[model samples]
Each structure stands twice: as C-alpha cells, then as structure tokens.
Target: MKWAGEPLRPQDAPALVSKGLMLADSAPRGVVYLSVPLDDWPEPADDTAQALLLQRAVDGSPVVTPQTVETLVTALDRASDPALVLGPGADTEQGFQAAIALAERARLPVWVAPSAPRCPFPTRHRCHQGLLPTDAGSLAKILARYDTVVCFGAPVFRYHAPSTEDFFQPGTAVYAVTDDPDEAARAPFGRMFVGDASDALVRVSDAVTASDRPWPAPLTIAEADTSGPHFTAEAILDAVDRGTRDDDTVFSLEWTSAEMFRDRLTITRARSLFYSAAGGLGWGLPAAIGLKLGRPDRPVVCLLGDGSPHYTIAGLWTAARHKVPVTFVVCTNGKYRALEEFAEALDVPKGEYLHIPDLGILDIARGYGLEVHRAETLADLTEYLKKGPDAKGPRLVEILQR
Candidate 1:
C-alpha cells in the first residue's frame, strides 16, 4: 500500500500498478492481487500508464540444488517395484518426454495423476497407464501392488470422496519430487524432495540401472460395433477415431462421462489429449479454439457431454467468427449423468436432481451460427463425424444417446 509520495492519488496509481506487476514477476510462482480505491476508477490513462501495461517478462523454472538431486538419485536407486505418477507439473513438453524416458529406463508403470491438465504420457506406450482416480480408497487399492510409489510434479494424493483408508498401505514407501517446496512441506506420508521435473527425471534415469523386469503390455481397445439403432458413447468415440485417422487431431475432453471412456481412444502423442485436471467443465470448446489458433496445421476436436458445454457454449461463436476448424462432438444423454451415478452410489432415493429434459443443445449450437448435426443412429453419427475433422468451419455434432 506504500506510495511514492501519498496514498490514493490518481498520479501514483501508475507507480503502484508498476510495483505490483514487478512483485508478481519476482516470485517462486504465486497469485498476487492489487487493490485500488473507488476514487481511482475514473482516472485517465496517460502514455506512462499505457507503457506500463505493454511491458512483458518471462520467468524461468527453478533448478534443484545438487544435494537434493543426490538424495533423489540415491532413493531411486534403492527402489524396487517402483511406480511413477506424473502430475500436472509434467505439463511441459520437455517434462513429459523426460518422464517417458525415465519410466522406460526404470521399467515402471507411468500413471497420470488426476491433477494433470492433460495426458502427459503416450497412452499407446507399454508403460503408460491412464489417470489415477480421485477417490483415496480406489487409488490406494491400485497402488497397493507396488512396493514404492514415486510421485512427480503433483501432490501425494488429491481425493474427491471421503475415505477411511490411508493413501498407501503399511510397508509401502511413498516419495515425491516436485518443484514447489510448499507442496513438499505439506505432503503427508512421503519423503519429499524439491527439483524440476524434467531435470530430476533425467538424473534419476541416468543414476539407476535399467530394470530387468518385463515392460507391461499396452492397453487394448475393443472396437465397438457402430451398426446399432441407438447411439452409444463407445460407438460414437470409435467412429470419431475412424474419422480422425487422416490427420493427428488434438482431442480435448471436458465432459466428465467422456473421461470414463478416454482409454478407449488411443493417444499416441504426448500432449495431444487435454482435460481439466481439477474436473471442472466449460473449458473444452474454448480450449479447442485456442489449440486450433495456435497450431493451424493440426485439427482440434472437443468431446463434450450434454451438461458440460453449457458453461462455455458461447465459445462456438468465437470459433465461427475466426472460422476455426474444430469438430465438437456433444454427447447428449439429456441429464446430468455423472450426478445421477453419484446418487446411486450414495444409495439416495430416486429424485429429479439427475434429470433435465427441457434444454436442447442442438438448437443452442445452431443459435451460435455453427454447423450442427444431430445423430440418432451410430451410422449417422459416423457419417457426419467422418467429415467433421476436415470441415471448413466449426462443426457441432450432437449424438442423442439415452
């Protein structure tokens, strides 16, 4: 709140803003907020203010101390039956590649933590596994098979449901390598170390001898029959897979239900698959548009559920305005399907919390002035999606599945 001369003056606002920006830049990564008085709102922006706004700087990722790196390398060398969990910190291209290299060298099954903003590992790899579930009990059950769990760039655990079980069973060791010391400090039941994900991965890979254990087999996807009368979620995705073979299109899944079937779709690229690690909706459509704009050569596809797109459906207009060629496949089940499952799991009585029959997303997509297609049968869905990837403008295909 300190000012150059006095507080709350219109002239001092520029200096205050400048100082705030500087402080935000000089950080170990943090959220900084600047407060201005109500009287400051109507102030005029001069050349100095304009110049302040135009300044930009790049912050570099922090490096690990030699001592911490030694400790990590020693710990990894001793670990047998070690499993690696790649977290959100592995979002960068280098970090993702390093993780894969480390996993391959150590013969470890690489699991994507639920905190990841996108898939960090190639799903088609022998060591690659999908995301860890948010339930502590479920996560513990799966991790129980391993003697040691090594976490990178994410917390020891991020749970969505209440569970009495500990993150790991007795005698199972847990270790973490993260860039954030704050995260390392608060972590429960783990030997935490601080390091950049990519660097640490490389160091660990080099220090440890290649494991003699056999690499796990890659997951197999069962081809679904798309000749049925009604549209099933599996069939729709299979069709999308068939249609998108011409070009390597990045698929963004913001819809929660679609996330369940994500393993069905093969992700060969490191960062091509994206979703909200926090499990929030409304990011799919807009994210697809941004991806298209950033990489005009590659096509983008958004797989959104019936309820997910409503939060950011207006993104379609921006796509149309820019003529971004994104294929949006909306899975219309006519209800908040995830919540319905939640209710059933909790043993709650049947209620209307799961049902919403009035709204039509097709009409809404049409209102946004994008090409819309509704599919009642699998054949129809496949036919429309076959042309979806190469479509000139943004295309919306709504699959009516019960």
Candidate 2:
C-alpha cells in the first residue's frame, strides 16, 4: 500500500499479485519485483482482479503483420534447401507440434537451437538432427549448407566462446520468427519477424508446397563398444543407454564426454534430456535431483564429468535426505577435460591445477549418505547401471575413466 501510495486495501491484493506474475511471465522473460506489506499478507484479494490476472496469463501472442509473414513465405519458397532451428520457445506444446509438422512437410533437416534446455523436436524423427554446435564458426558452417535458415522460437544462435566471425555465413539467408523482440535485436544477422513461433510455423506450413527433394537419410549413431575392460565416457554412456529404458528415464547431462555421445543416446522424447545452455558446471547433479522430484515415476540419471560433480557435490546430501530416486554417474577422467580441450582455443596452458587430486569421489558420495558404487571396469559399470532403472533412491556410481 505504501509502495502504491494508497491506503492498505485488502481488495487490491489479488490484482497486485496477479499483475506481478503476469509481468514476470511476459515475453523476453525476466523477474518482476513486488512488495507486499506484512499486514496485507492474510487479506483476501478482489475476485474480479484475480479473474483478470488469470486471463492475462493465458494471453496469446500479439498480432503479426501479414507482409512480414508473406516475406518469410516468399523467402522459404525460393530456397532450394531450407532448415528449421527450433529453440527454447519451440519446447511449448503448440510450438513443438507446429515445428514438427513444418519440418516433415518441407522435408527439412531440423536442429535444436543451443539455448534450448529441452529437445523441442522429437529426436527419433527422421528430420530431427542433433543440436547445433555452440561455437560460432562451426554453427555458421552448418547453417551454410541450407540456402535459407528459418530459426523459430529461439535466438538467431547461441555461442559459448566468443568469435570474430559473423553468426551466419555470407551467402546463407537467415530469418527468425520469435515472440521476443529482444531475441531479434540481439541477433547479429537476420530478418526477424515478431510473432508467435507456433503461429508463424503453421502459417508457413500452409503456404509452402512440399519439396521435390527426398528426405535426408537418418543419421546412423553406432553403439559404443563396451566390451573392453576399461571404463571410458563413451563406454559408460553406452552402458547407461543399454541398461535404461528410454521412455521411463530422463538424463541430466553436464559438460562431459557423455554429452559428446548425445546422438547415440536413446533420448527421443522431448523434455526428457536436460542440460544447461550457459555451460555452467555442477548443475547436472542437482538438476537430476530436481527432475526426480518432478517426475516421481521416471528414473532420473545425472551424467557428470569428474570436475562438474564437485560443483554441487552437496546436492547428494539433499537427494539422500529426501530419498530422491536419482542415479548419479560420475565420469572420472581425473582432469578438467573441458579445459584441456579448450586449451588451444582459450590459449591457456594445461597445468597441474586442472588435474583433480585423488579425492575418492565414492567416499564423498558415501559421506553424503548415498548408495554408492565404484566401477573400475566397463563391465562393472554396466552391471551396476543394469539395475539403475529400477533403483528406488539416490545412487552414485563413480566411473574411473583412465
């Protein structure tokens, strides 16, 4: 009341809270701060305002210009090869369905944008390609293959490392359809259309004729051979893939070699695979615990690199306390492998600091009161993980990758 410069009116509380919620949920997502006096905490809100707020939350995308829509349609019609890049926005039910329909109709190769936390398009679909690289130059090269790139519900692109090169190659025509104008503004190159991604995709699908070209051959992801005794990231992931039922399981991956084998993993469904687009370490373990809490019936597995697990090792304590059914597979490569991989790119020396001391990760997991297993061999890792899908509580498997 003091903030609004009005007397404390109990009736105003519902509308105030609803307004704050609406602001926070609006396009180009951000936080909205609302101050409510303690005295007003228990007061009832106005019924009319509460209803209005609820209606606003369901507010659809703003009206789109027909000319902009026609421009996009014309561009796509002229393109010899056009691809769709579905971003975080496409993760929505409507947007996801529209994207898939458009891709299938156009016989387009669809790639998930880097910023997406969940896979929007069905990974099992023939048109669904794997994620685009986060490297600017690498992504540009991939996009270059398409005469026109139609990015939907996501930013133009996302990059982990800074690069001087432009986001798209010189000849490739780039277009983006998004609800967020900020996303369009931030894009380095593209003709951005401000509209609902799902609406845009649906309209484009209706306008465009089917391509004369045949559907691209589906990628053949070979199964990693875990016959060797030694445990490696690929082998561990392969075993995990083999042992777990894809539909009933969710994988939360950190920046690890297991992430490198994403294409080979059996995570075909949308939202089943989770990872940080920001490239932060230690989120995988804690995220797995959270996912387990959300989907109690599904098995949640965290594939963490040796270095990332340390970022949130304490998460295991919380998982144990709640008896959250999460299987943590720590890929122990004995060093900060990402740093080593980036040494040349970052122009840094590979030093002792990057090497983790023998901290006994199993002991750490045990200390957190988790059911722990140490797998020194591939067979041991596979055997332990075979029971992971049926596990009822927090379990940590330390994989020694030499």
Question: Candidate 1, 46: how far from true, in Å?
Answer: 8.6
Write the residue-wise lDDT of candidate 2 on 276-389 in tens digits. Answer: 866778878888988988988787888887788888889989999998978888877678777777886878878898888687888998998989998777667768877876
Off by over 4 Å in 2: 1-20, 29-60, 63-69, 162-164, 222-230, 376-383
Q: Give a tens-digit lDDT track for model 1, residues 223-342.
A: 765655556677777777766664367888876765656766666655677777567778888989988888888778888888878788789889888888898988877788877777
Give the clash count for each candidate.
0, 0
RMSD of each: 4.3, 4.4
TM-score for each predicted model, relative to the true structure: 0.84, 0.83
- List residue ranges in candidate 1 displaced over 4 A: 1-60, 222-227, 376-383, 386-389
Shift in Å, residue 257, candidate 2: 4.1
lDDT score at residue 73, model 1, on the 0-100 scale: 62
**Residue 242 local lDDT, model 2:** 73
Q: lDDT score of model 2? A: 0.76
